[model samples]
Target: MTDQLPPQPTTPPPPAEPPAEPLVAPTAELAKRQLTPLAAGVLGLAIGAAVVGGAWLVTATTGPSEPATFTLKGTFALTDSVYTDPGDDSCRGSADSGYDDIAEGTSVTVYGAEGDVIATGSLGQSNSDETGTACTYKIAVPDVPSGEKFYKVEVSHRGTVQLTAEEAENGELAASLG
Candidate 1:
């Protein structure tokens, strides 16, 4: 008999690797989180109301504060026959006579309903009508307060002309001295 070969040693297989971790957590580990549709709508409405109420409060507190003011504009007409300049396009008045108040730089005053002076201005240069029989001076009194029931405007020492606040707002005031 042939000599028996030496018994070969057998090698065991390598051990298997452990499984990898999952990307998402298992359902048992996560808690449920959600809002009902009615609750969501009520929250949105509350936020909207807060914003609107805040805006209204700010507007009411800060103003409608400053009283309104306006310019009082009109004309002062002089019809004295003695002051007419027939040869020239302009009219002339004397400081010594009745027409003195119609001269340039005369003070124009605006009074409120309480008879207090509200504004003051001066007459501009004199302009003559086509016939030179009438002289008109422009009156521009600025910063006259509004909201008065009425106004009284005076040029120099001449009488005051009463005007409703609505009429004065039209800016068509006029005063005359002959």
Candidate 2:
């Protein structure tokens, strides 16, 4: 029997509760936690300075911005090739007009026949002011070789010159052949 059912109220369920708001830090607390403007600025400056200095150091130490290349250009024969110190195995040779393009503070090594380091010296300045164009390298050569000693010059910053009979025959002591 279709008994009169109690009035069934078709009401939509209550709307779902909205998600709770996340608990954000209080403004005062956030302000205290963050770095101050002055502090942040200082930190940025320090970081920038460090980067610049590091780059400069790397370039200065590792980069190859050589000033010049020395060349022995002239007609001069090496006659007296002896060591600055006779006791020492260093050798020294004289050329007429040679040319060399040596940096201010580089060192050069001269090798004699059989690959013996006959002389070594720093590219020193000629004048007291350290601004002269010409540099005389008083090298200490190793004891002269036995025969037809072939000599060669090398540097950490520039070119190498293999002592030759014809080229060493005559010329100006090259500014490069320091």
Candidate 3:
């Protein structure tokens, strides 16, 4: 038998080394490079100004709004024997009756405070009194602008009848051409 080699003391291999750190900076170190307070405030103000300016531009470019409007209603009466209704929807004035200009389907105009024609309509069917001595025509001018200090109504070029806003709106205007 070969002589056995002298026994030598055995030792475990060195423990494996831990992994190396990455090249990038840690999270806490990167947070320190964030924007300063003043820079952040300036950015916020710029955003706010842009928003306000955009709104202002939109409002300025828009066209003016339309005015409010209402229907003006009243009556136009011809209280003269010369105006006669022949059992028809219309009434006719005799020639040389002085009120010959006034008739059924005549133009009725509403004027604004500045003398602008705001609305125009025509006289409706005529209604005769039992005595046949008078004829009344309904006046309706639609889409008359409101907020005027006063209104003027004209019937078939007959002189205008002045009315306050309240009077015009309340249908208190009654014009007669005899």
Candidate 4:
């Protein structure tokens, strides 16, 4: 058997295609514009202004803030009847007499809801005694923060005097305070 090779025919190539339009239009003017430092800064400022303006507009549409006020026209007083023991060097170690002399001008403080010092006043000499006798302290807590739904009144004497919730809420000054 003889193996014979067959001749292949050559065909002409297809025509060249026309070039398609560019995806993006060429901006020769923009390409030529070199951003100076000053121009770049101005552009940045304009963009920043737009962002800030948008934020301001959003907040303005949200409306006003809530009111934070409390009605506190009343006066509160503090009274203590505590005595101080004077240590003695004598046989029984009992001293003469000692009084819890809460100073006449001792400062009083009222705490608010957040434990902030909301109001301050003094326990007057006319109200308390240096001789250890039970006395009434009148304090004009001009105003109490609405935040402080309740109040805790504190005074410093020979020791600290703090009024309980029951005492602070009492409208009657003398009995509740004392």
RMSD of each: 13.0, 15.7, 10.8, 15.0
lDDT of 3 at 150: 99
lDDT tens readout by residue for model 1, 46-127 = 9999999999999999867877899888888888753654565556565667665567788888899999999999987778
Tell me each candidate's TM-score.
0.59, 0.27, 0.62, 0.36
Write the residue-wise lDDT of candidate 3 on 1-178 in tens digits.
7799888869878999998977998999998888889999999999999999999999888958878888898888888755565656456565677777777788898898999998898887787777777788888788888899999998887789999999999988798877
For model 1, the stretches where C-alpha displacement exceeds 4 angstroms are 1-64, 81-92
Name the runs in model 4 displaced over 4 angstroms: 1-28, 45-100, 109-121, 124-138, 141-144, 157-178
Better of 1 and 3 by TM-score: 3
- Ordered from best to worst TM-score, the candidate numbers read 3, 1, 4, 2
Among all candidates shown, the one with the greatest lDDT: 3
Q: 1-178 in candidate 4: lDDT tens per residue?
A: 5587676668777879989978876799569878999999999999999999999999998979654543222333333444333452111111233323343455667775556787777655343345544344445555444444566556653323344444454433332344
1 or 2, greater by TM-score: 1
Best model number under TM-score: 3
Report clash pairs, candidate 3.
none
Model 4 is weakest, by summed lDDT over 10 consecutive residues, at 88-97
Encode model 2's per-residue lDDT on 143-164: one tens digit a residue: 3332333556665544566765
lDDT of 2: 0.47
Question: Which residue pairs of candidate 4 clash?
Answer: none
